[model samples]
Target: MANGLTVKQQRFVDFYIETGNATGAARKAGYKKPNPQGSENLAKPSIKAAIDARLKEIEDARVADAREVMIFLTSALRGELKEEVVVVEGEGEGVSSARTLQKQIGAHDRLDAAKQLAKRYGLDGDGELLKLQKEKLKAEVNEMKTAPSDALHINFTFDRRPKDGH
Candidate 1:
């Protein structure tokens, strides 16, 4: 046993992290009764700590930190990311030799990424610009609501008449 945990316990921790299923991990670890031992093992301090540490290690390796996120956002804003697009140079031909060319990402996507980066990095004029823009839009909407409708209005008044025309 390593670190005071049995071999099966270590295996269980490994499988648990991989499968994310306690009972399945226990079964894979060769536990006789996985149903009960699966959850019970997690309650053990050593196993829990080992699992937590391993998970942290995996996250540290697989997950990106704030700096990485910022870098990615910057790259997206700069349109450095590319997408595969099929361009047909010769129309009316069934299969034309088309070459994929690297082009800047669409303005819409780049603008979206830029907006997020701006908000995240305090580049939106300390939120004051956004707030003012929002206020301006709201005022425009209010003005539109109060503006006279150009829709044509028609009213018809009919006098009540008896069936006998009396």
Candidate 2:
């Protein structure tokens, strides 16, 4: 409404969030058929801003914020959580014992979680890693392009006879 979106435009926002696809959302919103540029139209500044506002509203209602995510990941990585198990013995004279088993997060799991946190906080050198990977891939592509065709060809002859003297 603030963006002056029409009824159909508002419906498009709802469908977009539901489908996570702009073209499909436009179709579901009862927009014109065969609208190949539906996504492009949605990319317009006003439309994009409306969508962003709607998404923020939905996220604020349903999703956890960054701090909550960090706390959860930190707890998981630290293995501070425990699993409760109840053991029962005998049916009539049942004896129940409740036990809490500490969940041990493996080194790999902790490393992965830490890496994710680092990435979220921009502490990981992801840009450098990406640059290195890009350079490596470019080098490989150049090598392939400059490689001699004969280098890829192999000739083999097999003398299957016992070794000249059985």
Candidate 3:
């Protein structure tokens, strides 16, 4: 009546003041549910007790943090870890034309795959198709030499495997 809080109410009020979370303080203070009457809810002393408990926990945590900061400051005063640090600033462009170059490079790789398939079909060493393939290979090599370094890597492995031991 004098203040909104009795001595007991003041304790709960103090808890909420410290923790800043009524629900958490309530659970911490071991409050399960309010009494059956709606009037016996958060407006009640029991609920305030729970809130007070949570506030204590928050205060304890803040105290711990303050202690850690003090320790760290003391250590720094004693002179530890003075290594030089370098931080690079970002230029902010992502993947600059990389995909375009990759596709161009991939085209050359596809050509090489076709060449392999041609050989497997026995078309490259005998038919008119074989003559066309040789011309294509020459053009590809010339194009590759002129292209940027990020362009495809072309590798050819010659057969050392013996003909089907017939």
Q: Number of the top candidate by lDDT?
A: 1
Q: TM-score for all predictions?
A: 0.58, 0.40, 0.26
The candidate that wins on TM-score is 1
Looking at model 3, report the run of 10 residues with the lowest lDDT sum: 95-104
In candidate 2, the residue pairs with backbone N, CA or C atoms under 3 Å apart (3 or more residues apart, or in different chains) clash, namely: none
1-166, model 2: which lDDT tens digit per residue?
A: 6678888888887888888888888888887862664676577887788889988898898999889889977876787645454454454556555555545667787788888887887668995687789999999888877999767654699877797766
Off by over 4 Å in 1: 1-4, 91-100, 129-166
Higher-ranked by lDDT: 1 or 2: 1
lDDT of 1 by residue, 2-49 (tens): 577899999999999999999999999999999999999999999999
lDDT tens digits, residue span 1-166, model 3: 4545455445445544656555554444445541332234356666555555666787887775745754544444444424343444555675222211111223444455455555555666565677788899999898988999998787898887789854
lDDT for predicted candidate 1 compared with the true structure:
0.88
Weakest 10 consecutive residues, lDDT, candidate 2? 82-91
* Ranking of candidates on lDDT, top first: 1, 2, 3
Evaluation by TM-score, superior candidate among 1 and 2: 1
Model 3 residue 2 CA deviation in Å: 31
Clashing pairs in 1: none
Q: lDDT winner between 1 and 3, please give it.
A: 1
Q: What local lDDT does model 3 show for residue 19?
A: 62
